[model samples]
Target chain A: MELRGKELNKSIATRKKEVLENTSILSEICQFLELKDVARMRSVSKIMNVIIKDSQFIWKPILQRTFPEVRILDHLTWQSLKNVYKSLRDYHYLTFEPHSSYTVGIIGSLGKLKPYPDIHSPEIESSGIFGGYSNYLLGKHIISISVLSIPSIKSIRKLRAEIQCWILQVNGQAQGWENVLDEHVTNFKMNQIKSSQILIVINSDQEYKTDFILDLEKKFKIVILKYIDNKTFENLTKAILKICRNDGETERKVYEKQLIRTNIDENSVQETNDSNNCILS
Target chain B: MFYNFNKIEEVKIRLRSAEGHICEVEESAALMSSFIRSMIEGFNEVTEVSLPNINSVVIEKVIEYMRHYKDKDPPIIKKPIISSKMEENTSAWDAGFIDADWNMVVDLMTAADYLMMIPLRDLCCAKMACKFKGRSIDELRAEYHIENEFPSEMEENLEFQHPWRLE
Candidate 1:
């Protein structure tokens, strides 16, 4: 009886090995794994690593099944699908603290704003900006720039900020920066900021008047001021303006037309409405 | 030449397992397997189908599944199963049906694949995936009896190339 039990155990072990070694069966099994799990599975053995890395068959079905609305565009190669899967899994959140009275103008490839479901802190108001059109661009990519009224160190500690947005990429290129400024401005208007004084604060370290800033100065009334906090703002604004020059002309036209309308309807209290008043706070 | 529905339902198909054990199942239940259905179609009078790769134990389990799902379709198991527990990811019946030892699940998966029973194959695959879900590389290797074939340098390089691992 003991020998019979040993034989059965041997058969079970053999069957387990057989199932694991079979590439087709292994691949089918992988289709139900999360992206991170699949990545971890690659380290198991040479056969598993090859089965995962060599083809898109395993990844494609998982991607399609998980995100049915997201279409895999023609330009994306099979090799990049794994990376795409990883990016989709990584949810991007924008966190900042705004002063009580300061209305923050967020500009980026943002869709309609909805409350972020994950945060439970009542002190913090978190909104997730769904990038509807940009979802077609690439895997829910978002780049967000937040314009905050200079916060007192006390208010910064008091209020917690978490904003989510999609950053767009096309053909593995960082295309979110292109024509994003105009979209940012449009989204700002949609948020209904009635402030006549628009502040364009640059960080203390960055060169004061980049051509992009100069171009922005041409469109809005000019004041250049320094901000001490958050070095990320400098890099983000520079990146946005650096790419904003070439294709920005068309968007600039549409923005100028909107600006004229906003000045007339929203900021009627200000007497001189030649260009929207921008004060560097 | 009209056939009575009750008569067709009364037909029994005999399945011969690898261990030469014969199991009888309703014709309608047996036809759930595309492999058996094709065999029956090819030879109209074929009442017994041979499954050489599947053992008697696994074949009996497959027959149970076929009998339960004879008149209806199995609930679809969603891809990238959200939970590690099979019960949370699928119907209670499916979860209970698949609640077996790892060896049994593997054998059932192999049998389902051989029999061309896609729903059963997918259910088994999902159950297997549940074992793999949220497990670390070392854990996976240990559980599956896989030897780490990569050298230290190659493993490091592979880790560096992993997009998700960097973060």
Candidate 2:
């Protein structure tokens, strides 16, 4: 069945006339897509773009339906709302406009590590996640945790400051030097280390007298690090290894006595290092 | 088969256009053909008002559409509630209308949108989207005048080398 009719007009004037009537609807459609400011949206002919920004343009109700919350912003767990907003405004779309606002996901403060009030301590300052909007409230958007009760304003401000500092310094460098604290000290994966060896490096000046050192020496499993010459440290490691290899009971006992006196041991330290081989964290 | 009427009797009565054009027309016929009358009404409301950059051709089509459906139920024509069969029928018709050269299709769509022809404009753009689907990045760039700004090896290195992409 041929369902057709000869309604075609060959004149340019006719074609132009029909298209002229359709321009108003086209402008409304572009606004509905929420692409008025988008470069690609702007490229849909010059005339359409001009009427896109007008206040009289009432968009359809569906356009008002909220867009899916961006999970990408949540991945920036360490960024301040300000920094996140800036990155998003520069790289991605955030309902972005000069007068618009963006909201980042909520972030809890480090002080949120505190337990319940009945179990509180003075050293654990009362800090919390604040639903704060910073700058023109445009750059980085964050949805802050809702406060159930009135909290101390000063404490929350302190938390906000710390959170901002953390966001600014999130460059993959650990918070402090590894040698100063020891490996795995500040790491979250403490379970990865099956055992721990307390290695104490003591200064050798005459004023280095403390009950702490005497108390440490009472253990036959510690390694006391002193300001010894390089050669002496090598000799000490060799002697400790030799003691572990000995078969005689008397020889082992003698080595054990030396470990207690000088605070050095080899067998236990080697075993501690071996446990970390099979774990990922 | 014709009834003779005196010229003086015909001259006794007068007809006027909606725009105040003195002419001859059958009032009964004009009332029955409500589409033409409404088109004239639309013209009176819209003309003498300047749309700075709008082309004349688009306006003509809008008028043609207004003339076609003016006497029909306005709200029903504007927003049709369709059954499954009706939707399928409309889809088939829309597909044919939109199947045209890309530039012509875009022009029609842009025109339809500007004048608030919702159904026609939406179907055409959706057809365009289907045509664009599965196209290669290079093809898309060529068609849309988009630039491949990412340097060579960028696709491979961007994920692994960036510290943020790591856990």
Candidate 3:
């Protein structure tokens, strides 16, 4: 028997045009598709390929949906967002790598090790899982540092001046290093170390002991940083504050208040003479 | 044909399908469709709405969904819910409502898409997406009627590169 009718309607079983023909429907379908499906759908046809690729142009929502709770910055474009996502994926399969580099004239700083730089500290390797995005070697790193004494001292006051110069250099290397009694030590420790030095510890004549053998190994961590943006290369205090702020909203506010308080106090203003402070301080 | 015997005033909506069939549904149930809602609001006096794209069978399925979730809002499935949990948590009725052949599901999705019924669209699409997950290239091609664009040798190489297929 042949089926005949005034109107022959198409069966719903043959229709799939909402996903194939309609743009918004196709986009909504694409959102539900798995990542591998998205990649595979590209191979389906030229139209599907174009649609999926265009979806990436609106990548901010896609990325947020992919990884919720991450505060994605507005400045991150699609290309950069993809790069960061790929790098993060790369992080899972990362293998360990060893790095051994040295810096001289460091009295006692190890990589992130705090308290007394003792050379007998087991020859430890660094966690090298993370590396530069352009140039940031993340995670723990070991650095062998050598100590040096003042080159020449003309007088006692001259030795104190040289010691102050040395303290400035060490603190300069630590960049954001802060110590409550750092200035006090620079003013007094030069003469005290000499008096405390056993008479046999001199590298030269007693009257003009410009050099000494004091192996007081203390562990201090090594940190060298260069912020990405050039605008951050202003006053060291401001740069440090700016970096702290970049971490999050709450920390930024707390650190901002700290910077304001620290900026107000000076040696003269606070009446603490570094020259008159105790030798060990 | 509403079950109400009280003979109270009830608003009736007329929907014309693509096959030229007219379906009369209650205004409250029809308002669940954003497209129909807009039409009702836009032309307050109009009783019938025409949908030239959807057919009788798919339109009946769409109305079944709309009427089911009319009084209470359809619980939105955030983050694309489709799993054993989706089957477990969904009422026996919702599961049965969307239970159709792949092509029928696709048709219903199209109808829901036309009506701007987001929940039904999402449900249908996610169901299709579930069919694609963990299926091989051959299985997907068979199921979705997708043409295999790659030769055996190239497809083998892609499997080697992706390695996700290996799992």
Candidate 4:
């Protein structure tokens, strides 16, 4: 592929060189006879016409140059390829020539133009562009940019640090301990927070890792909580085993791994016999 | 050192100036082809690369844009925060950058044209049109450096009273 590309480029360069020399020689002969340019040369009748008609003649190189990229003879003429690259390259400046062209403006339906309110507006200001509500209450806004934030993995990792700083922005108030429960509930209601949360515990009895899960459950209902699944869970388990087995916590590691891998349903209650068997065995 | 990132490409382009300082542009297939075509026909390196219409200021702006966008993907039809006030209350950054005399604006547009920077050229041209949005042809001529070519009677007949201007 590379070799073919190089050969093609060389061919183009050769053609361009021939065209350049032809133009230069024509201009030189025109200058000698005090003729203006190509148009004037064309006006000099039969001999010039015969010179132009010859395929290999230097004078008619312009016609050949018109369609250099076209190899098939069916569409090789200058007039046929007038709208192609040659004409564009030659007449680029013509587009910008004053008085030669004009501009047209097409106005569609003129919608009611309303003045956008400043920051001091009393109510929530919503303007619809093709109908996606921009939720701005009391002038808190989101400025949509032309470019998307194509975050790298490094940038995505930095987002964890910024999570602490990202205020949920609930009505101009920051959520702390006093508001965590209600704030979480409000976000849940607004469909903003995640419905599920995962808790991973390795070697619960020996390392007191169960204590952390119990404390969390005491604070918030574990309505949708579950452990990790498959490959990632296996990797995490291996890492945990590597950390704990060397630290004299074999009993806790065995029990906790089994407990986490087990799935539970909140709505369905197993029979008392099965429940006892689950907890005991 | 020039082809540090990519090994396959091998060509060099020289951008020249009046002081004879030649800045070498690393060859990419697209740019090198255009450069070679320009350099043909007794036009040397200086004549090929030197944009006579683009002064240093506009060239600096084009280079700035290129630097900013080198590693980025092309922008789609994402609507940027167009200043809420239809030609008023632009962000200070955008306003200040674009607020140049008409000559500088035209120079920047020409530079954008030479560098084939579509967005910059379009922005400058659109800004020029926006500035003359509701104005008459006579007003546009006065604002731009365009000379009036109409006969006096025809010019009088074509006069339009602009709606936006208080005067």
Candidate 5:
């Protein structure tokens, strides 16, 4: 059965590759890639280059997936997919807070928009560039302020420590996290967080363990919840995650694996699950 | 998926997949595929439907979804919104169902496309789009097993092509 599965996969893959390369199926699969990446893949061969250049159908799925609420009958000279991706990200930056996450202590509210009281109305201090806004809020008012708590920060530290430990072990007497970062710990001494240096750090450490990205994401999420409000957190989070982001969306992918965990009625996606309606994660 | 027939045996439809694996599914479950629905409507009460393009593996997985959603329609994914409730896994069973390997998913997508099952196709595509999020060009090539046949000049100037990504 295993051999049969392998053969079927192999034969089908080869056949599909042929059909895709020869027919318009490559264009179909190219539809799945971002426009810039499509252009990048076009670099592969003249056949692909011609297929991508001639391909006018990429925006169809992009429009369908990005803007489901509106029906655009007319053709559009689409802006770059990166622009569309950025604009679509505006959807993820909703002010609404999930009632379930609000109810449970799992997520501290940065002040719910409506349908819930803004108990403390979180005193948010803005970080101009990185949007890494963090202002300390008092006891009972923490939920209204931010999800960042002493415990969460402590956990963030622990997460960073674990990574540093792993990096140290992997380096094996070479420069450690401290030596690499020039002994700065609490905050990054430099703002080169998204630099290729960090990318190298992420890629090198990721092979040792799968959770490296997930762990980075966990810390990133914790860091954002500190002074989060709409695009502030998401913008910063995206930048942070862009450095070390893997296929893992941290909690979402893992919980999704334990199927049957989600029972909430997701039926309203067609009618009212608009960007404004959903609470930001 | 069985209920008491009270003396009369339950009526079942046979699905002959590409590999000749025959699966017995209820009529209602089989009707989830619009193609099958039309076929059933047009034809005389035939007991079997042969799907030439979809294999047994794809059939088995598709049937699993059809069986589960026979009664309730799967949620339509209109836009790309990752829910806050994704942590609890409440109500989004279709996402979990379509979580197969790359080859299986592509095949299932092909089968779904052939069957004209828009919901399943959308789910598969949306899931694929979700994976596409935040992936680098190198990563995309690696995962998709596509070749980079860029001429040296284009390769040298690739970063210049997408200046935004370089940002």
Candidate 6:
């Protein structure tokens, strides 16, 4: 009885192997797996690796299922689909908090951000001048960085030409900083600033300086106040500071709306007024 | 000839499995399989269908699924399943229904494919996916009995090419 049972188990195992060896069946199985799982499956065997890497049949359905909003153009090859999957996985929204007293500069190459294992709300701080480089693994390129809550339009007007932004890419050899942001770019509205390059706001007038060096293998450093004069840095800092402030009115209105819904009595109205005073103050 | 609607409802379809065992099912339930439906519709007064690839065990399981879902549709399993657990990804009944051993699940999947039962095929696929989900490459190879064919250097190269696979 024991011998027969062993043989039966062996047959079943063989049958299972046969099923997976069939490419058509394997493809069906892969369709149900997540992108990461599918990517990992490529390492299981040579056949699986070829099946996954070579076939569009496996990727097309998985891509459509995972990201239905992403349009699959006719020209996209199998490799492109794989790249799209990886790119979407790596894409993130990065928030930077520059210190008030220090001149902050962000220097890094695009698309070299390291992947974090866990998904968390990331808030990168700008370290002070001569403050050792704080390396932030960011995405391929900056699509848009909107100031979360602008204080007021009046403050925005005060921010004009105060913030200087630059995009520095060091290819093979070291080069000087290129001032990428023009006057029009500096004169951005309350929430309409869009740039493909990095945005660095430095309070040039202050003695405290924060230099951001992107930790790349190639030694690339942001030469502080070397290319542009001090006036540009001061203007850049004012604009950035204005953009970063939290809108007090918006916060108070949200609080008022919540309080009014919960409390209908006259005492609640008085409490709402008190809360508004607290927020404004 | 004039046919009564009630008479058609009372009809039973005979499904002959590979083992030459005959199982009777209500015509309505049997119609869930598109292959069976086509067979019944294409041929005149045909009630018996032979399944050469599906054995008695798998056919019975398929019949169980067809009967249960005859009145109402099975719940759709979402793509890119959220959880490794089948229960979280699908209805409790479905999760339980597909709670058989891996070999049985694979057999049912093949049977469902042959019979053109898309929902059952999809359910079987999801059950199999739950096994593969969140598993490491070595774990997957062990689970499926797949041997790593690539040399160490090639494996390292592949890993370098796909950095996202690294944690």
Model 5, B74-102: lDDT tens digits are: 77654443431222222457666766666
TM-score to native of every candidate shown: 0.53, 0.27, 0.49, 0.25, 0.45, 0.55
Q: How would you class the docking of model 3? A: incorrect
Report the candidate with higher lDDT, 2 versus 5: 5
Model 4 misplaced regions, further than 4 Å: A1-281, B1-14, B23-53, B73-96, B136-167
- The DockQ figures for the candidates are 0.43, 0.03, 0.13, 0.02, 0.10, 0.41
What interface RMSD does candidate 3 have?
3.6
- Chain B alone, model 1: TM-score? 0.87
Model 2 C-alpha lDDT per residue in residues B1-167, reported as the tens digit of each score: 97666543421112232234333333222332234344445665322223233344433433444444435522221111122122332445344544666546656566555544555465554544443333444553455444555555663453334333221
Question: By how many angstroms RMSD does model 3 differ from the true structure?
Answer: 19.3
lDDT of 2 by residue, A1-281 (tens): 13322333233334533332344544333332322222132223233223432312322221222222322211111123224334444556454443232221111221222122221223223443233222222224322211111133233233332221111101112243223223322221242211122122332222222353344334322332223333233323333333324535556456545544333232232222321111010
Q: Could you arrange the candidates by DockQ from highest to lowest? A: 1, 6, 3, 5, 2, 4
Error of 1 at B166 (Å): 8.5
Pairs in steric clash, model 1: A141-A166, A141-A167, A142-A166, A142-A167
lDDT, model 1, position A142: 25
- Best first by TM-score, ranked: 6, 1, 3, 5, 2, 4
- The stretch of ten residues in a row with the least summed lDDT in candidate 4 chain B is B77-86
lDDT of 4 by residue, A1-281 (tens): 99998997666545433322343333322221211123223322233323432323332234324322222212223233223333345555244224221111001111121222231211112211110101101111111101011112122222322111111211112224224434334443353322221112221111121343345444322211122223222222232332322333455345334433342232231222221112111
Q: What CAPRI class is candidate 5?
A: incorrect
Q: List model 6 lDDT by residue over A1-281, tens digit each.
A: 99999998888788777766677777787788888888887778787777777766777678768654343322335455555655566653222223322212223322122222221112222111111111111234211211211122233333323322322222212332222222323434233433322233221222212132232111211212222222232222332333333234454346434434433332222222333211100
Clashing pairs in 4: A203-A252
Instruction: State the TM-score for model 3.
Output: 0.49
Cα lDDT of model 6 by residue, B1-167, tens digit: 98787755678999999999999998999999999999999997889999989899888899999999999999888887778899998999999999998789989999999989988998998888887788898887887777788899988887887766654
